[model samples]
Target: MQPLDAMSVFEKVSVADIPARSARRSKTTPLREAISALLPEEAFYVPYFDQETGEGFKPSTVAQVVGRMSKDSADYRYSVRSEASKNGCYIICNPKPSNG
Candidate 1:
């Protein structure tokens, strides 16, 4: 869905944002890792693109991968949302830093 207003904000996360597993750590999905590498918005929305790799991912594939994680995933302290744009479907990851 499209963002209802212009005030909505998001941040792209990175592999660095994700913590390493503990001796009893939880599992991480491929989707979760990818979402972490997205771009976060400061004043405005920035589209998803991997600068280090000089490549991008299909929004649809992103959405599906993240969706799977939501069903059976660890608490990564970030949330994923999909939005519609003139270009196509895009994904956003909102940071929710956790202390655990």
Candidate 2:
């Protein structure tokens, strides 16, 4: 897995299976149902703006890329984006800065 500054996972999730377990949601739980979770808090926001115009993106108008480590030993997706969100993929990302 690649080194990432942070990780993120869906705000909501479930773990019921087979015979069916009590459908309960616990905020304090450490996301056990998920085989692994990505905590995207580490992603940096790279604000893209027109060079000539100082004006920049709106609340939801942002795009970006991120390199995050895999939460589990198995293969997994590195990042996610939110559509429908005016924030365009609700979350914007950027790479961590390198030491000079």
Candidate that scores best on lDDT: 1
Worst 10 residues of 2 by lDDT: 59-68
lDDT of 1 by residue, 2-96 (tens): 66786567777998998887664223343455555654441123244456865444655555566664445344323434344533344444444
Predicted candidate 2 versus true structure: per-residue lDDT over 1-100, tens digit per residue: 7456556554654555336678777531322222134343433232334457654343222322222233332344344354443323333222333446
lDDT of each: 0.48, 0.36
Candidate 2 is scored at a TM of 0.18
Error of 2 at 13 (Å): 58
TM-score of each: 0.30, 0.18
Q: After superposition, how far is residue 4 of candidate 1 from its true place, in Å?
A: 54
Query: Measured by C-alpha RMSD in angstroms, how accurate is candidate 2?
Result: 18.4
